[model samples]
Target: MILLQANNVMRRFGADVLFHDVNLQIQEHGRTALVGRNGAGKTTLLKMIAGITSPDEGTIAKSKDLTIGYLAQDQGLDSQNTIWAELDLVFAPLHKMEKQIHQLEDQLASLDPSTRKFQLTTEKYSQLQADFKKRGGYEYESRMRGILKGFGFEEDDYQTAINSLSGGQKTKLALAKILLQSPDLLILDEPTNHLDMNVLAWLEDYLKSYQGALLVVSHDRYFLDRVVSDIYDLDNHTLRHYTGNYTQFMEHKQEWLTAEWKHYEQQQKKISKLEDFVNRNIVRASTTKRAQARRKQLEKMERLERPETDDKSIHFRFYSEKDSGNEVLDVEKAVVGYNDQKLAGPLSFTVRKPQRIGIIGPNGIGKSTLLKSILDRIPLVSGTIKLGANLQIGYYDQEQQQLHPEKSVLNEVWDDHPNIAEKDIRSLLGSFLFVGDDVYKLVHDLSGGEKARLELTKLSFKPINFLILDEPTNHLDIDSREVLENAINEFNGTVLFISHDRYFINQVATDVLDMNALGIKHYEGNYDNYLEAVNKEKATNANQDESQTTTTKPKKSSAQQSYQQSKETQRARRKLQRRVDKLEEEMTVLEEKQEAIKEQMSQPEIATDIGKLSDLQKKLDKFTTQSEDVELEWTSAAEELEKFDQENS
Candidate 1:
């Protein structure tokens, strides 16, 4: 069944048309995503479909009795009630039914058993009970609690006043409330803006099992890929439907664009030939009739317009003028905090040359604080942070605090590089999409995305070997984020950044630093690899626990048993240690071979020979596979040895 439909919708802002002839439908239990670049009228169209605003030239129709729960971008609750009380309002009808049932019970107790009034009251009470059960009255509180917990609210937080909560928390509460309402359709705009990885995972799972249709606008590609099955790409002031996840939609869109361009080009060539013939031969006496016939054909033909494309995005690459030492950064037993209070650590980690490390943890666990501590912008509570030689660091602040509010966009970059020509600076700013009058806009007047682009322009203006970025992808659209990823990959520099974008991390991070209140755990690969290793470790611990619990042997002398266990443990530790050492040696050899193959491939002479390149490429692939296998084996063996030592010690 169709839950909602927008037919021939047109929205306008005075003389400007945002989008026209937009059409789409939401079916029962549909999972749809609305995607586009920033400022592509996605939010505007969503408002019209959600009935928060009216379309200027079309109708939005919905199924009879349909209920919509629309969550605007960063929309928060403005309520004076306690958190629990606010959520409890969603079950007001059930509560009222419960109260009536209680009143009926009281009346029944006081009335005569044979009276019609008593019998009528009993029937009414039973009906109320059935209705309440059907409405999920018994499970409402539990369901609310589960959702609140998923949003990071503790039981103690239930009594907290809604007005006192932070903006992000209030937004979370708003989503939680809407979810509890369980409307016929849910419309969310950038719901993942304030969510961490853990909460994002939870929300994805919840929406997968949601009982209603969903229309969401999000820049989180990873979330969209997992939760949504249908995509409506709002581009060039129109919507195009594709029946698949975000990845599949991209593939289909690319194919469509290619076909559209080919057709347009073919039409353009035909028109050009006809026009040329008409222009050159119409004045000739011999070809007058032919020209007239060609003109008639041209007049009857429909011309194809140019294909539309989105090319107004920032483009730049990060490159280091000089290389840094192997040790880019070294943190030894570092504890990061504020006002002398410890937040996270004692942590120890070493960043080598050209290693892009992604720091991840819960919201308040001090991932950003650790970055500040390393840069000496904030003092570490204890321990040391050392930077390697020949290093120049560029930091991208998530808050855009580095920009001066009073400064023009042109001055923001030009002031930093006064030696450069003004025209050259303008050219550079134009590449970041700050052209003409936009270059003169005040920093404070620019949007979040504009500020982000301005900041990136500044970062790219200098030569740096180390990048320390905090939530770099926060304000960027998916396209811009992908561009940033490409720049990072192409750069010959070391990077240590904090981000909640799982897709961005997977694309750029060569390693992950999983921080906790206790310490930081190092993983040798991307986010998925970290998860796999963690799961494997948990399974190993579980198996060890089971083996210990299931062991049932006859009791032996205390001295003998102690001796035997100690001896056996020592032998096992030795064996594991030897295995670890052997794996480490094998890994080193494999890595060296891979590096050698890469060096050979990079040579100019070898690069020009197709046969030689192919043979070298095959060798490189084989060595790369071997290296990864050995690396995994080495990681496993080292972890086992570490666990054994900790337990047996």
Candidate 2:
């Protein structure tokens, strides 16, 4: 059953069209995700769907009885009510029913059992009891507790005033209330904003079992991978649906774009050949007739628009102008906090050259404090922080408080490096996606994402041997996060960073140090590998087994049989390589057809045919699925070939 539908929805701001001709449907119990780069109008479309705003044209039809709970990007509960009080309000209807039940009980006591009034009273009382049980009246407090606990709140904190809570705490309370309300359609914009990994995992499980449809907008790829089943991508002033989570959406989108680019390139080639022929032979007597005929055919042909690839992200490498010593940093028995307080005590760690160490912990656990201590912006209560010789530090503050709000984006970087030309500074800004008037925007006016990019722009140009980053991926979209990961991976220096982004840690961190108010626990691998190890240990303990091997099994083949195995590997490699070759050929043909359909869609005569347009969209979606599958198979085959060769050697 369809719960909500938007037909031909369009949203425009004066001359700028945000999105148009968008059509979507949310079915019962559907799990949909809205994703795009920042400022691509995802939140705007979400508002339209949630009825906070109306579309310029088209209709949004919702189920007559549908109840919705929408959580905006900056959700907060601002009231004098305590945490428990705020949450209890979600059960207001149940409270009213409870009051009615109480009154009925009193009336029943006064009425005679033999009267018709007594009989009717008993029937009503029984009906109310069943309704109360069905609506979870009995478990209301327990349910509230469960939700609060899942959001990293203790029972003791439940009665605390919401006004006294932090901004992030208020946001969590708001979300908890929405969850308890349990509306038919739950819409969240960036719901994963203030969630830590542990709370994030719990919320994922909580959302999975929810008896309602979900539409979410979040940048947490790992969380989305665990929750959403469908993706609604807002790009190029339109919404496109893909049948997968964030990772799968990325794969499908890349494949679709590849096919589209291929089509455009093929069309351009044909046009180039025809144009060359017309220019070369149009004036000649011998080939003039044929040239004129070619020109006419070219004019009749519909031109395919070039794929937009104007997305600008920072592209830079990190290298130390001077190499630091082998021991980049050393801290022993450190107590990190402000004044006389201790956030984490007896914390000892050493950072070596070229080691990318990721610091992870729950919110307000002094991860940032630790970094500040090392930078000497704050003092350590106990242990000494030693830096190796010839060291230069680059720090990225997550709050972006280090930036000068009064300065323009151009002047922010230019003031530091006065020797660099103004044009050069603009060029650098362009790499970070700050182009034209964007560079003139004041730092205070920049979005969180823009400020992050600007900070990165400054950090990259610095000749630093060690970097200390605090929640560096805080406001970055997935693409920018990946770009930062790439830069960090390639940097030939030591790095100690704090991040809640598990995907970013998995890609860049060589080691992870789990911090808390107590102390730290180190893991010697990526986030996924660390979790695997932890879970495996837990499973062993739960099974009451202490003898399970944590090490990987060795290869069975011996040195004596190496020659025979090498020959076998060669044959396998050849087979896999042949498969890759075949997939490439199929990809080319699919791409050409993709472009042909796009050209047809762009034709002015066919554009007005709604049925034809819908059919083309469906066809395009099919092509995307097929192209992704082929690409995946090809990648696997290529990897298999490489692995076989490496193993045989």
Candidate 3:
């Protein structure tokens, strides 16, 4: 069943047509993502669906009882109310029903049981009670609390006034309220903008398990991939649907575009040949009829336009003057914190050159503060920060304050690096998606994301070996983020950055610097490896804690010693089993290779070649013999491991 449908939607702004003859149908429980370029009619279409703004010409239909909850980019809540009070509004209906039921119950206790009016009122009260119970009204408060907590609102902040909260905090609170309402359709615009990695993951899980449909407008590729199963691309004043996640959509779209381009090219070639033939033969008396026919066919043929490309891509290049000595940054007794809270310890650590380090912590922690202190933007209470020799740093600040608001986009790059030519500056800005009129736009008028791109453009144009980036993925769409990630992966410079984008960190980070209550702990691995190490450490700690509680004193009994020995033996057997599993995987590869060779030998053309046939036979025999040996070893190890487990049990 369709939850909402819009037919022949036409919307325009002044003299420009945003979209024309657009038709959209949102089905029940559909998860759709809206995507397009910056000025595309994505947000405009969403507004029409939300009924916040009327389309110039369209008919929108919704189910009789359907309810929609729209979260715009700038979510405005009642500033005077507290966060708890705002969330409580979601359960206002239930609260009213409860009050009415309570009043009826009081009247019934005081009235005669035989009165018809009293009996009717009592029956109505009972029905209301049942309805409330069915809707989990009794646990509504707890459910609201849970939703708020899941959205990263703390218990203390719940009582804080909404007016005191920051813009990002208010957006989170608005999202919590929307979730609690349980609307039939959810329209979210840039929901992941203010979310951290953990909160983003939580929201993803919630959306995946939600019963209603979702129409999200976001630039976060990873978030879209997790929450949306379909994409409605609003481009060129038209809508195109792709039935898959973002990655699959990219693949399918690429394939379709490639095929279309090939057909278009072929047609163009044929048209060119036909035109030449017509030109040469039109003057000949013998082929006049044929020439005329070809000319008519050419006139009727439809021309194909070339696909648009991302031409405004900055040419990113890095230059290293001299490889820094061992240490890139050194901090000693760093007392870093805000007004009343201390996030980490006053400890010391060394950052080495050529190390791609990732700083991770919860939102509102001192991660950003630490970066500022290192750059001398913020003063630490007590610490000495040392930089390596000749360490010219290129910083990508999340706020992008380095950009002058009055300057044009083109001038922002060229003014800083005066040595660069005007043409080269234009080319650089173009690479970053500032083209034609976009280059002339004032910095103050640019969107938050566009400013970020411009900052990166400037950084890329400069020659620097050390980079300090904070949330570099901010304001970048998925494709742009992927391009930035690729550039970073290929860069041969030292990098220390803080980002909540797990996908970005996983792709680029070579070392993990975890900022927790215990201070900055260095782990030598990528994000996945670091997570595994942390999990293993947690398991070990849990085991130690359990053992400490169970055995406060040393056990001197012979049976206890034997049990411990048996446990050790079982662990060793499991380790051997893992090795045997590895060997079996290798053997499977060999068998697959042997099968491929046999299939090739069975081919008629290959069978005609004696030399190739002999080679295949030899390879098959070798693999078969190796497979048998692997099977034997695997079986023996399995049996031994099973015996050890049985003994331990």
Candidate 4:
């Protein structure tokens, strides 16, 4: 049940081969991940597998009737239809069937019951009903609603046009549509880019139940660990498969590289010994035959090439001009936003010396704005922000706002440090992996990864005691991110940064500032520790919930409580309706008995039988009493149901 396979696949850029003779296969319900460095052509390989691009050298085989759904990196949904309408399109076939069923119903009602056309229409309606039910027509809307909610879209947002959403929201909408489609093979590239923790967790749960093959390309290690089981490492113009999650892959990869390099080194030493013997003895008169034999053997020996490795990663550290005071920053009742509209914060926080704080929140909750407000790049809506003595802040904008796009890569850094010698500046740029021709390239022409590297280069040279970064790891590759993390961890400076990379936060953050509409709250620990605390608190609250289920007290999570309440209301209404139906059934039996009793009483033979008439009269009285009681019970149940519905609604 292999859905797709790329055999002897080759992809190239100009004359440079990205990967050659790469073979990959995905089963009908397999999960695989394609991982490599940023410039290792992972995306190109994905496009080829997705059928959006053709392989340069080999053919891609697929099972007949294979449906592939590809969600590109940051692919946005731009449509005139509302969010609900866009999602509903996933069930287009079912929707068409629904319309056809209605038409058949109309035809059945209008046609004569005895006609052949009526029978044919009835058969067609039954067939359509079966197909529609198989396609989940009855529950598609509810599925759409649930998936949308999981992606952070509320019921009210369903009516909003797709084009009206932000880029991140649109990307999420696209992901939701693909998940609903449930194609045989799902190829997703960086699907976790814009999702918050809530959405990310929901997606993990959803994908666990997805009945399709998944081939994903992402740098989110935690996401990879949770979602994928196998890893395809694309390195040095080839692909190697590894078993297990991201953490396991790292361990296995290191073991493989070690073994490979060891074999190569052993062969190299043997070849060196043979060459030395041939060189020393071939010129001598003695042992000429032996030298000839050695020469022949050396010529015949198969040489092992050195193991390939990507080692030219950026290496630099934050250089502090001087240590700042004990208190680096102070904010009292600070509101951060644009104009008069507040995104978050009528809040307070302190950044002490050398404390690395990571800011986290949902998209558009003003995490970046908070950084700018503290730096005084944008005006605060209210209150005060104070910087302590001997503070020189270095800011890294995720968008690369600090760099001049018109300037060369070298000049972007050199222009800021005009006093530095040209040779020294070149040395600094070289350390950041901008060497020779790379330095001459304009900042605008640099790729996202390059821009990030260049930014880090500039930041490393800055003598600052306070670093404020907004999404600093946005464009960095896994290797560079790790290097940056090391630098940040080692830096003796105060740090405040906004990031959605949980791995990065976990690696570098000493404390986390959870931002929301209400304000920012401080948690003392790394991201993982904070999550543990939150989960522990949830479990505690859940235990309390059991005891307080009958109370009117408010719950910690309003959303969870509301969902539980709605489920309970639905259950109660269903139970009440069932009781009403039972009463109706009982009443029907009693009425039928009464009709039989009356008919017997009306019979000419029975009219003369006084004893039979008395029996019939008693039976009629019993039936009447039973029917009246049933009617009362039915009325009471129905009334209670109505009242309950009103209260809940």
Candidate 5:
């Protein structure tokens, strides 16, 4: 069943049409994600669907009793209410039903048992009780607790005043309320804005299992890929539907666009060829009939115009005049926290030149604090932070409060970097997708994403050797995020940034700094490698815990003992096999390099001269790096093999 349908939806801002002739049908249990660039009217379309705004030239038809829960990007709760009270309001109707049932029960007790009124009252009370049970009223409180907890809210936080909560916390609470409501349709804007990985994973699972329809406006590609089954791309004053996750949508959308451009090009070529043929032969005496035919073809040929693509993709390249020293930042015995509650270390780590580190933790777990401590915005309780000589730091804060709201976008860029030419400034702004009148728009009027882009545009103008970005991808759309990610990847300087975006981490992080209950642990790998290490540690811990628990238990039977022995033997064999595999890989690399050297030696002129000998020596030096890497691998593999053999013996 179609839950909501919009026909010929047209929205305009003054003389400019935001979207026109838009038709959309949302069926029951549909999960759709709306995607577009910043200022592409995604939020406006959502507002229209939620009835907070009206379309100038169309109607939205919603099913009767089609309860909708809409969470805007900027959601607010009544400041007077506590978080618990705010969520409890979602179940107000259920509470009312329970009260009415209690009243009926009292009336039944006061009535005569033989009376029809008494019998009817009893029947109604029984029905009410059953309805309450069916609605899970008995388990509602527990369910709410679980939901709130999954959203990174502690039990104590439930009673916290909503007014005291930060903007991000308020957004989370609002989302929790919506989840508790469990309406027929859920509309969320930028839902993953403040979510951590754990909370995000929980949400993805929850949304997957959600019974109702979902329409989300989010820039988190990973989140959309996980939760949304379909994508609605709002582009060029229209809506286009793609039947897949974000990744698949991107692939198919590009393929379709490519095919469309090709078709347009082919038609243009045909028209141009016909016009040329007609022009050349029209006045020729020898081919008047052919000329007439060519002219007819030219006249009949339909012109194909290409659809306009956004010319405002920001081309970001960081300007670093010179490289910093080997060590970019070093922290020794750093103790960082607030209000006497310490989060993580007594930690020490060094970020070398060309190092890209990702700082990850839960919502309030001091990821931002750590960044601030390094930046010297917050005083470390103890320990010293050292910066490399001549290090230039470029920081991108998530809030973007650094930008003066009164200034125009162009002024914001030019005010700080006056050395940049007007033409270059415009080009730089255009690269960040702020072009023409867009650059002229006041900073105060820009959306969060737009402001973020503008700040990035300004940052791109400066020369810096080190970057400290806090949630850099916070307000960016998917495309903008990609552009930033590409820029960061191309950067040669060191970067230490905090981000919850897994895709961005994978793309940019060369090292992982995980802040947890224990101090920050440095892993010499990206997010995937960190996960693997974490999993391995977890498995090892679990095995130790299981072994200790088993040892404390009563002695097992012979049959159980035999099973345990077999399991241990199999584990040892698998470990040995893994080591053998690594050694084999190392041997293969060594053989390949040796073969390459032999081939190089087989060259006739290069074999006998001093110049050739020098060239061969350079090749040998190049081969040494590869050989060293393989040797390291082989050593580790050999150690693992020996350890496994000793354990078995």
Candidate 6:
């Protein structure tokens, strides 16, 4: 059954139409996601569907008695009641029923057994009890507790007054309350905001099993991929539905665009040919009839509109004037904190040239603090940080404090490089989507996304070989994030950045740094890779625990067995180390071969020689493939060896 439907929904802002002739529907237990570029009217559409606003040109209809629980982006609860009390409001009807049931029970105890009043009271009491059970009266508190805990509210926090909670906490409480209500349709806009990785995982699981249909609007591609099964892309003043997760949607969208462009171009060619034939023959007397027929056919034909292109994105590449040394940065036993208070530390890590390292951790675990310490913006409590020779560092602050808010957007970039011409400065700003009159806007007036783009424009303008970024994707839309990812991948530099955007990390990270308050754990791949390794570690630990519990050996035998296991582990480590060394040697040789072939291909004589160039290109390709294989093997072996050594130590 269709729970809700929007037909020909049209919204307008002032004189301009945001979108029109929009249509969407949600069936019972449907999971739909609304996605679009920033300012493409996604939130507005959601608000219209949630009945917070009215559409200008269409109707939104829902099933009779349909209930909707809408959680807007960053929508917080404003209540004087305690956290538990606020959530307990969801059970008000049940509470009232329970009260009446108790009153009925009290009356039954005093009334005569054969009296009509007693019989009527007994019947009412039985019906109330049945209704209470059907409505989950007994499990409501436990359900509330489960939801509150899932949103990170503990029993201790239950009594805390809602007015005292932080904005993020209040938002969480609002979500918890709405979830407990369990409306027939749950509408969430950016619900993943302010949620930690663990909480995000929990929410994903919870929503997967949710009883109601879900309609969410979020830029979190990873979360959407996990939670939503369908995607509704609002673009170019229209909505297009795709039947898959975000990843699959991207694939299907590309294919669809390709096909649409092809069809459009083909129709254009046919129209052009017909028009040309008519123009040439229309003046000739003998062929005037044919020309008229062709003209009639042309008049009867329908022309296809040009396919919309996604060219409205900021486009730029990251370039380095010079290369940094092989060792870009090295931090040993580093403790990062502020004012004698430790946040996260006793950490050690090394960044090599051309490596993009993504640092991830729960909120407030000091991932950003680590970057500041490395930049010497804050003093480290202990340990040392060293930068290798010829290294030029570029930092992108999450707070964007580096940007002078008082300066205009054009002046912001121009002030940094005064030698550049005004035209060039404007051109650079234009590439970042700060066009015509936009460049004159003060930095303070720009939106968060605009400031982010402007900051990136400045970063791109510099000639640096090392990038240290903190939450770089904080305010970027999905398209802008993809552009930034491409720029980072094309950069010939080392990058150490902190990000909570898993899709961005997966796209750009060469390694993952999992940080915690206690310490840091290094993983060899992206977010999914980190999760895989973590699961394997958990399984191994569980197995060890089970073995310990079931062990029957004496203490001495166990000690000897441990010693033998240690020896075997050492042997395995040695073998892995040897494999790693050999692969590294192979990779070095393959890289040299590739460079030599490229140099040969670059020669003026060889460049002009097609066969010679082709042969060298094939050789280069073969060596590159081999190099990638060897690197993968080396990574696997090195990770295994690192684990073994850490275990033994």
* lDDT against the true structure, each candidate: 0.89, 0.86, 0.81, 0.86, 0.82, 0.87
TM-score, cand. 1: 0.83
Task: For residues 293-332, write the lDDT of model 2, one tens digit per residue.
Answer: 9999999999999887426566776667888999998888
Alpha carbon lDDT of residue 433, candidate 4? 84
Of the two candidates 2 and 5, the one with more favorable TM-score, higher being better, is 2
Once model 1 is optimally superposed onto the true structure by TM-score, how far is the C-alpha of residue 643 displaced, in angstroms?
A: 43
Best by lDDT: 1
Candidate 3: C-alpha RMSD to true structure equals: 14.8
Number of clashing pairs, model 4? 0
For model 6, the local distance difference test gives: 0.87
TM-score-best of 1 and 6: 6
Error of 2 at 134 (Å): 1.5
Candidate 2 local Cα displacement, residue 523, angstroms: 0.6
Candidate 1 lDDT for residue 456: 95
Please provide TM-scores, in order, for all candidate models, with all chains considered together.
0.83, 0.82, 0.77, 0.81, 0.78, 0.83
Q: Which of the two, 2 or 4, has more TM-score? A: 2
Name the weakest run of 10 consecutive residues (lDDT summed) in model 3: 308-317
Tens-place lDDT per residue, model 4, 135-221, is 898999989989999999899898999887899999999999999998999999999988987798888778867899899988887
Question: Could you tell me how far off, in angstroms, the CA of residue 633 lies in candidate 4 after the best superposition?
Answer: 84
| TM-score, cand. 4 | 0.81
Candidate 4 local lDDT, residue 47: 89
Assess the local accuracy of residue 130 in candidate 2 as a C-alpha lDDT between 0 and 100: 94
Clashing pairs in 1: none
TM-score leader: 6
Give the local distance difference test score of model 3.
Answer: 0.81
Off by over 4 Å in 6: 544-649
